[model samples]
Target chain A: MAAQKNNYRILTIVSLLLLLVFIGFAENHLDLYIVRILNVCAIYAILGMSMNLINGFTGLFSLGHAGFMAVGAYTTALLTIPPAIKAQIFYLAPLIKPLDQMNLPFPVALFVGGLLAAVVGGLIAAPTLRLKGDYLAIATLGFAEIIRVVFTNTQTITNGALGLKGIPALTNLWWSFGAAAFTLVVLLSLINSSYGRALKAIREDEIAAESMGIHLAKHKTLSFVIGAFFAGIGGGLLGNLLGTIDPKMFSFTFTFNILLIIVLGGMGSFSGSIISAFIVTIANEYLRFLDESIKVGMRSVVFSALLMFVVLFYRHGLMGANEFSWERLFGNKVYQKTLGRWTKRPRKGGYAG
Target chain B: MTLDLFLQHLSNGISLGSLYALIAIGYTMVYGVLRLINFAHGDIFMMATYFAFFGIVTFRIPWFITFPLVLVLTAALGMTVEAVAYRPIREAPKISILISAIGASFFLENLTIVLFGGVPKPFPAPTLFTDVVQVGTVAIQKLTFYIPIVTVLSLLALLYLINKTKTGMAMRAVSMDQETARVMGININHTIAFTFGLGSFLAAVGGIMWGMKFPQIQPLMGVIPGLKCFIAAVIGGIGNIGGAVIGGFILGIGEIMLVAFLPNLTGYRDAFAFVLLILILLSKPTGILGEKTAEKV
Candidate 1:
């Protein structure tokens, strides 16, 4: 058992080293388009995983992700852009106060964005946590729309609909993929912890969870704050990567894209979300070439069709709740192919929690 | 605001409000029975305009023939969507059903995008609906008068149907308790399908009027209206039809009043419905007319 554990550890380190080396090589040698697409995949993984933590693991069904991302994107964009660039972008209504003068490092800006989003998430989550299911969904959606409306109207702060321009190209593959990896490790550990058990308990039956002294509000708030934090990180990466962002970018459709990822990947599966985020983003680009090849927005036609198919027929999706662990790959196992269930023996020395 | 300006906005608000009410009645009927938000409803309404557009513009059918044809076709389309997107997931978790509705809505939107392209097409309003009329001091489109009349008539007809007819009783019975309804020998499938068809018929009326009022049609135009009408219905109480009309009028008038009083906030017009939605959610999960529902463990 000790030897197997050591092997898993060694294998993990070696694979991570290989991944870093590959990223370094790709950054230097691959086509810029490929590298950019790769960065998008990583950012999407971060967004998808965060959404899954709330909507899937915690069973919150919150649709306010795009709002949180907007907060993060606008915040990070403001902080990271140079003072001169900020002045130029906010020509319609100059950057408010210290924002015009103060500029921060990319990493710091990303953290601040995440912090602000987490604060907003906590605030929104408190009043909304009392609601459940569809009502909760609508309330969160309302908040997201309100954030968008305010962002659009507050031209001085968000630069309004004109959007920020000349944003520094600070998001490299390293920052994006690194953030994705960090999100994965943290979220994975959270899911396996005692609090995670409590969250899953709340999801299964809220009343029963309350009866078991799970302190539903505390666990719910914790998940919401954490989810918003990582989503903020993802948005910051996206903003810097694209070098421009408007309030329009963070519409409900943006949330829908991540929703598709989690649904296709299997909502409760962290690794599955990461995997499907790559698959769906890559597949969508390629699928855009179908038939007309020139018309925009045609890709979503087939994409939504596939989504409907999954929702109707293969509801648990690609991985269901089963995670991708090396133990399962190495264990002598019979494939229980009755359908979407993947039962497995459990073992763990849970994460940092 | 001057009295003339206030009266002008009021007339416009009443027209828009009635349009919203016209659509919300259908939305509430389906919600009352199925308890699903029918996210695709707005899309279905959008499709109605296109049907009328093609009938009048593309094929050059006369207004009377095209209008009735559009209603029938829209009702059929709604029933088809219910069968395709909803029927299979009838027994699934609430989230799945909601997801399915969203997917169906997206499919319809994207499908329209692919088939019709995303450009906004000018709706061909018949002279009867769009012609100008002088209401004392205000110049009002004939549609302004027709809309409220249609809304009130539809509401009265719907209330009469639900309260006075056998099918209406079946709908109420089914909504109250599906198992008992089934045991009582109600054909659950047919009744649900009929409700979808009827609700969709009303939405078609709103869509046609909306096309005349706005004078343009696009693939994605249904999204905002769909959400707002749903919000309006929620404010009126989801299960109550009469409440939906009141909610619609409130939303419509309130929106006009907001812009009239605060001209700078016009950009935030779309956000107005969502703001109202949040306030209602906070103050009353059950709207004025909504009955209290206990959570069953």
Candidate 2:
């Protein structure tokens, strides 16, 4: 067992080194389009993982990620846009007082955006977490719509439907990958800890978890807030990457895209989410041809069809709530049994001869 | 506001409210039987308009023949949606079914967009419904009168069906306990399909009337109204037909009055439904007319 543990440790170290090398190579060698796609994948990975934290790990089934993303994106955009740009964008209606004068570094703005989204998540979760199943989904969906509508109407702050432009294109592959990496590390550690166990217990059986002395509300809120925080960061990164954002950009369709990633990945597996995020982002870009040749709605139709197929045929998704572990793969009894059968067959044949 | 203006708003509100009521009934009935929100319900409503549009415009069919055909086709489409998207996952987890419903809704919306294009098309409003009737200083469309009468008649018919029909009893039993109903020899799938058919029928009627009154149709037109009507169903007590109608009227009138009273906030009209939904969820999760039922472990 100790030897197995040592093997896993070495494998993890090797994988990390490989990933770092790949990132470095891609940064130097990849074309602009490929780099842009990679940045998008990294951002989507963060969003997918965050959504998985709430809906998969915690089993909340919340649909408010887009709203949280909107908050984060708008906050970051407002803070990072130069005063001159802000002035130009808010020509129809003057910018809000403090925001008009404010300009912060990209990192600080992104952090603040995430922090505000977390605050909003906490506020929303306080009352909403009491509900379960579809009610919770609808409520969260409603909150997301409300947030969108507010953004659309609030001319002074969000510039209404005109949207903010000239945002600094600061979200390179390094920043996006770095943020996604941070999210993965934090989320993986959290999921392995006692709190994660408590969350799983609640997901398995709420009454049983409560009887076991777990505070349901507290743990649920923590998971939700944490999820919101990362989702916010993802949104901020997307805004910076795009260099332009409007209220229309953060519609329920945006939430649906992230939901598709997590659902395809396997709801409860962090590694699965990371893998699926890249697959989905690339698939979306590749599927642009279908949209252009056929109709704009073809891509969405294909995605929704895929979602239904997954839900109906493979409820457990690709990973089935299991993490990828090299140790487990090599040490599997099924693998050993198959190997034994193969080796024994030749010897048996020789004896017969 | 002057009494004359208030009367005009009142008439407009009632017309909109009755249309909302027509749609909400479908939501409540389907929820009652399936315990599924049927996210595709809205898209089904959207398709109904498209069906009518095609019948009248593309096929050059007269209104009298086209309207009934649209309703029948929409009903069939609803049942097909259930059979295709929902029936396969009837025994799965509730969340899976919900996701499937979302998928189905997405599919329908996008398919319409693909086939019909995204641009808004003007509905061929019959001269009869679009004619303006003047009373004192108020001018209202003839639909304003016809819609409420139609809503009341439909409500009565629905109530009669639920109370008097064998299918209604089966629906109630299935909703109460599916396993028990199955044991009692009720064809659960058939009843669910029938419920969807009925809901779709009502949605078709509502959609037709809505298109005529508004005279503009688009692929995404059903989304907001569908959401608002769902909110109305929730407010009135999901699964209760009368409550859905009442909720619809309340929501409709409330929305109009809010805009009238605070014109500056007209932009936030869509947000109003969600705010009301959140408030209702927080304060009274069971809704106004919803009966409390304990979860059985």
Candidate 3:
């Protein structure tokens, strides 16, 4: 037990050291464009975590993650973009006129935006949570599509499809890393807590969990709402980074992209999500040049090919039943052999544990 | 509004509703047998219309020649999808298959965009389909009338196929219990592929009719209809074929009525479907004709 604790401490310290080194390298050596890509990647890591919370951990199939993100982005944009400018572009006062006058700090605005999205998510969850599997997926997808349409048509606040612009640039490496780090820490803690165990129990077997005195509905709703909250914050960060916000940006395509990320990462694995989020973010950014060089749709063709190939062959994603750890690297061979056997065990009946 | 306007709206609603019902049949059939939501189903429908468009305009084929060919090809394509994309994953988790379905959908959609630019193509409506039918209060187009007629005929044909045939019996048996059906020596794979083919054929017919009615075709056009049909299938009870038709009609008519009667809520048309979905899922998730079963862990 003492040796295991020592291994964990060493692993955490090494990861922290690597994170600092990478951040410092990005800050000092890389150009602004590279830094921006890193920022987007960090934001996606947050979004992936949000999706993982409900989809990976709780076993809920939700295609409405983009809708929640839109709620966050629009909320942040409307609240922070000056009222006079909003009035001129939007041609109408928002339903919440009071929000227009208040321009809080970026972090506070983002938090509130995430909170509002959580509320909307809660409202959606109230009824839809009763659904399971594909029904839940379809319903959530509809809700996301509805949210997109609402944002597009509600010209009074969202500026319709024309998009919202001229928001204060609030995103930086610090905020991105901070939010991602905070999410990882909080979520890891929660998963280790009793609440997370109940969630896992529900995910594994809703009926069995119910019989075990776990309130299935309550846990599912909580996971969903909390996921939406972080998704909102991620959206806020994305909006600020992009320096423009449009309803079209939050369409089914966005949802699909994030879905691809979670699948490419091992769903339910935080470190996996974080790693793949960066990998995918960079791949997408760099691959834009491929599209420009060949044709506009070439990138999508490649992406689709990769997605299909992954689905067919690498069902477990890039991590593939393995979590990043120090035990495999420096531990004794017997330890390695036992760990290999344990990880090799089939992950049946539920998601990865 | 004048009586003429009201009648026009009603006719329009029915026309759209019938098209929705046609596509909803496909969703209901596949869901009934496999309990799999084929996300790529819409892409197949989209591809069929594109096939029809190119077959007529580019190949300079007669409508009579192209229509049947398009149906056959589309059905075959759907069967191929099941074979290539879905069959191997039959025993996998439903969610994995769903993601695979979605991946196939995206792949096909991107391929369409690559092949045909994102610009909407004007589908050459056959002259017979373009002729107007002048009712007393409303002047409905021939295609509008044709849509409902074809949908009803297809539904009747499907009902006959499923209810009055040996293959239908096998399908129903498999849908009830795959293991038992297999034990009984039913060819589950062939039945599922055939079910998909039949469903795709119906979707192709609907797609052609939709292209005629809307007079515009695009790679992404099927997304909305696909979603709406899914909603209809859910509303009518997912696995019940007749219920899907009813649900499609209700959703189509409901959207039109909302727009015509309550113009104030016109913007909420899409959201309205979602709201209805949430309501049905909460109040009666099994749908109007669906049976309840406990989900196994």
Q: Between 1 and 3, whose lDDT is larger?
A: 1
Predictions: Cα RMSD each: 4.0, 3.4, 4.7
Q: Where in model 3 is the C-alpha error above 4 Å?
A: A1-11, A91-96, A320-322, A329-353, B294-297
| Model-by-model DockQ, in order | 0.76, 0.84, 0.65
Give the per-residue lDDT digits (tens) of candidate 2, residues B74-165.
99999999999899998887878888888888888888888889999999888988899888778888899999998899889988888889
| lDDT (tens digit, per residue) of candidate 3 on A194-283 | 998898787788899999999888898899999999999999999988889898899899988888888899777777788889989999
TM-score of 3: 0.93
Candidate 2 stretches with Cα past 4 Å from truth are A1-5, A328-353
lDDT for predicted candidate 2 compared with the true structure: 0.91
Candidate 2 per-residue lDDT, tens place, A1-353, comes to: 46647867898899989988888989889898999999999999999999999999898989999999999999998999999988888999999798899999999999999999999999999989999998899999999999999999999999999888999998988899999999999999999999999888888888888989999999999999999999999999999999999999998888888888888899899988999999999999999999999888899889989999998898888777988787465556786577645532323333431
Q: Candidate 1: which docking quality band?
A: medium
Better of 2 and 3 by TM-score: 2
Best by lDDT: 2
TM-score of chain B, per candidate? Answer: 0.98, 0.98, 0.97
Candidates' chain A TM-scores:
0.92, 0.92, 0.88
Ranking by DockQ: 2, 1, 3
The residue-by-residue lDDT of candidate 3 on B108-158, one tens digit each, is 888888778889999988989989878885778988777888888888988
Best by DockQ: 2
Superposed Cα deviation of residue A205, candidate 3 (Å): 1.1
